[model samples]
Target: MDQPQNNPKAYWRENLRYLILLLTLWFLVSFGAGILFKEELNAIKIGGFGLGFWFAQQGAIYVFVVLIFVYVRLMNKLDRKYGYDEEA
Candidate 1:
């Protein structure tokens, strides 16, 4: 039988990077683009959707959903690499 191998440090680092990136994006869209820069973004509008309005209403949600999926994907890959993914 082959023994499973795992690198805790690598796993933690990858997870941390993924989380940080996701949080940064969340902060940027939720706070930066939605509130802080609302006035500046107001100067630009796409069709009937204003920049801040679009970001607050749809873009942020979309990005959040995508980020979750991306995290799941990366975690799955990491698990596989570390022999921790049962589904893999």
Candidate 2:
């Protein structure tokens, strides 16, 4: 049996850290590229459409899906590191 390295508070802090990081990335991709930096990204073209337009319409969704998988994988690793992983 594995024992956790830190107390509940520490565990939660780490969890929140991961959440914040992942959510920040999602927000940056969805909003930053889609809206804030749209003009700059618009200078680039992808498949006959502006890069920012693509990001707003489709790229953000793809990034979000990828982020979901990334978050899950990262959390699984964190859980294992902290001895919170489920028994297989």
Candidate 3:
């Protein structure tokens, strides 16, 4: 019987795709909102603080935490799809 082969390259490609996407979102939230769009965001107020200020101080951290969870969830799914899950 021929054993099935696992393609590490494909798995790594998918992993990289998820990493790039999540990192891009983190960068956008941290740098784009905090700096590039700060002037525009400052026009809006969030809890008596400028939107930019909030993003620079608190929002970025919140987004990073959420991203961490998202990455875990996505990687879990990926692992299952690739038959690499420990449960298997």
- Against the hidden reference, what TM-scores do the models get? 0.81, 0.87, 0.92
**TM-score of predicted structure 2:** 0.87
| Candidate that would win on TM-score | 3
For candidate 3, write residues 38-81 as lDDT tens digits.
98999999889999999999999999999999999999988877
Q: State in Å the error of residue 73, model 2.
A: 0.9
- Flag regions of model 3 displaced more than 4 Å: 1-5
- Mind giving the per-residue lDDT tens digits that candidate 1 earns over 60-87? 8888898889889988887887778897
Put the candidates in TM-score order, highest first.
Answer: 3, 2, 1
The worst-scoring run of ten residues by lDDT in candidate 1 lies at: 1-10
Q: Please name the candidate that would achieve the greatest lDDT relative to the true structure.
A: 3
Q: For candidate 2, write residues 7-78 as lDDT tens digits.
A: 678778888998899889989999999999999999999999999999999999999899889989987987
Cα-lDDT of candidate 3: 0.90
Model 2 segments more than 4 A misplaced: 1-6
